[model samples]
Target: MSAGQSSGRYEAVIVGAGFGGIGAAIQLKRMGYENFVVLDREDDLGGTWHVNHYPGLAVDVPTTTYSYFFEPNPNWSRLFSTGTEIKQYAAHVADKYDVRRHMRFNTSVEGAQWDEDAKLWRVALAGGETITTRYLITATGFLSQPHTPDIPGIGDFAGRIIHTADWDDDYDPTGRRIAVIGTGATAVQLIPELAKTAAELTVYQRTPIWVVPKIDFRISERVKRLFRRVPLTQRLVRLITDALYEFFVYVGLHHRQLVYRRLNIAASDLAKIHRFLSVRDPELRRKLTPDYDFGCKRPTFSNDYYRVFTKPHVHLQTSGIEHIEADAIVANDGTRTPIDTLVLATGFDLWEANFPAIEVIGRNGRNLGKWWRDTRFQAYQGMTIPEFPNYLSLASPFAFLGLNFFNTMEYQMRHMDRLFGELKRRGATTFEVTEEANKRYRDRMSELGARSVWAVGNCAGSRSYYFDPTGEATLLRPMSTRAALKEASRFPLTDYQFS
Candidate 1:
């Protein structure tokens, strides 16, 4: 259908139905802005929680801290809730706030181009449908796209090969030789569970991850009842958890020397101690040990990850992959290991920045992807770019707090509300961050990135998704969540051009 014939123009078009999108929708509704629609590529509302259904899939962060401040759930069964619970939480929030009505599921946005003359955005859809909007909010998260490495004979494999993101629940691995590639966050959680069922499990490790103890436990019925009865009790717990997580950010990303260094040292010592105690053989311990600093890459929390290595049926392969044979994976040393199932836990593609899964053309018909590629991926607080007027992106480069995404979404949605409120108050048709303002923010991020562990030290050798193709740390914001919220709250609207 034609751009004007498909659907009437909307005030705002949210390009996701994930946590960020739902949060944005709720905020818009609260702000008395109902002329918005959230379009999702998937048939369901939940984003990460909807797609990932691998075995042993659970949140690393505590349930209290990982949830939205405005919409807290008092019925969490565990400290670290499973993926299903998180998905249910997302659905609950969506239903409670009446966000589902405004959502168009199974509708993928192909591309978006700014109409300079009309002062509107023309959005193309996958099914030759189009829609127009005054404001475009790209809420597509970083973890939406899965990345599987292109190994030789990958397509020629006789056995079933599945990515963690696309796991089949019916495909039982019992009595099957399974080879799991990439030992990231997903691998750490799934390995322990897979070890219990698989006849033989081989973990292909490219790099060792720093795994700390996961202090997870079931929330007693009494505690749940208390939380439900006394809301302040739960709020206090969330506050404490937030503070602890913020401290982690301060030490790991910001300070890194004074108290942070000491904490890191202590953590490193504990990890070493844990490794020493967990792995019986010294060689195996050494192989499992991470040479880089604790916070160089994303730190995982798992009590059973190391314990699984002691199993007789489980094997850790440190040898680099040469290629994937028809029915086996060939090692760099010419050793071939046969496997029935190949599970790739390689994680998502974070560097692509391909939100909306489309080419976004802004002012002067300049492509957003090309502009980002040429000038390095950047945005004003990872929200607005210079040329992309009336465009705001959530879960973009330099926006992530590296801790709780729910907190980030809350802060970002608040910031958006303020921006939209100001636009309405000023009777502005469009708004965009000034080049000077964007440059200053970009410079500050670069300065902070230089001091981060991902940019220096042993992290140089660590193959982390935090760094983009240009070798710049563009994924995470090197700032505390509180600091980020304060900055977003207090940033001058004068830095933005309202027209």
Candidate 2:
């Protein structure tokens, strides 16, 4: 990686060292590809876990379900592991599996060019380093980029402004008025934690989410010992959780009404729980209740969330913020509340994670942005983009069930691994998905999207980030898990021409 001179050869180059990237690195290293690098912008492992250190940050899914299946952890202290615990888990996986040494920390892949004749990927790094590899694998996760909401008076604010992705530990919230904007997953967990410290807390809402209780409990020391002793037990537990959560996709594929009913019941149960858990304010309850179906956006889970509204210092603002004035949030209803600090819990810039700003020129000087834009950034089974040979998205479009992202990540990785194996067997490097296959794949997705909850989720005329503007569903796979496997297996990859 010295200057502009590319070593002009590598078996593969991976971008991002998150779970997917680490997983790919493990597979490739085991496959005996030594001349490779796992590039990450951050100077560390644990992609999302390395970045988001907000208060009370933890996985909503059970610990067993959240972890990687290839190497399961037997000694989790809690059922729902905290952010710190999860990050440590990622570190352990990297160290134990011996994948950490292959990583290029504090480095980012600016763009990639496909060398048609040489069948190598010319990848340019953030600085002046350029690495050439026969194959390129991208694991930059879909949710890794934080999209801070554009608020007025942001620069004018004298007090410290914080984003959930970039948490400021130096600015203490203790005995201060804190305003949290965006009631997404990040806000849900953070609000309760903030309440414990802030003298007064105000939660701004554009749309309230339908959240179920996040059931959590500590795993006994004896259980950990047992898991360590009998490693098979941990795998058995993971299999069970994977199956249980996988059913959320199953229902979406087959029995839609029942799943919808269950989602509704869970939402209704929240109100009853709030009766005993939250503040006894009628307007607050009304504001929190979502008119949309449960699965519209990502559903949040937490036992303490509803109870947070009951805190004496907490206030729920449903009128939506009109604008941000200096040291205050102005609501649309003309209500102004003075606050010292503002926290943006708004979700990440998921759609534009892959070089939304940079221009990528492929072979024939085909602009990657123009190609994706013309084709709507749709992929074949949400894996490979046409014209971008040796390029694959760790992106899960229709495949994103919002229940278990890791499950889809594993599936997508398996497909990628197979593709690489084929490349090695044939001694072919340059590759691009056929336009016919991509069109069929996108068409199939549209039909599946038509019947899924993403299409049916009644959102009071509001739209979730899950759906694209065209009204065609962009998230949540249409078929069952079994069907997805079948489709994945159909990728004999002969449709891809190896130049």
Q: Which residue ranges in model 1 land beyond 4 Å of their true spot?
A: 1-6, 353-356
C-alpha root-mean-square deviation, each candidate:
2.1, 2.7
In the range 42-96, model 1's lDDT, one tens digit per residue, is 9899998999999999999999998988988999999999999999999999999
Residue 454, candidate 1: how far off, in angstroms? 2.6
Candidate 2: tens digits of C-alpha lDDT, residues 1-499: 3112326467778788988888888878777777777889997999888889999899878889887667778878898889999999999999998888888788877888888787678889877877788777777776777887776666676777888988987878899999998888888889989999898999988887767766778999999988999998888888787787767556633345776568556655765575445546766777777777666666778777777887779888888777787778888899999999888898787655543333456668778667765656577777676777777666545655456667776667667667777777898766788888888888878776766666655654445776654555675666665566666666757667775
TM-score of each: 0.97, 0.92
Q: After superposition, how far is residue 365 of candidate 1 from its true place, in Å?
A: 1.5
lDDT of each: 0.86, 0.75
Q: What is the lDDT of candidate 2?
A: 0.75
- lDDT (Cα, 0-100) at 283 in candidate 1: 86
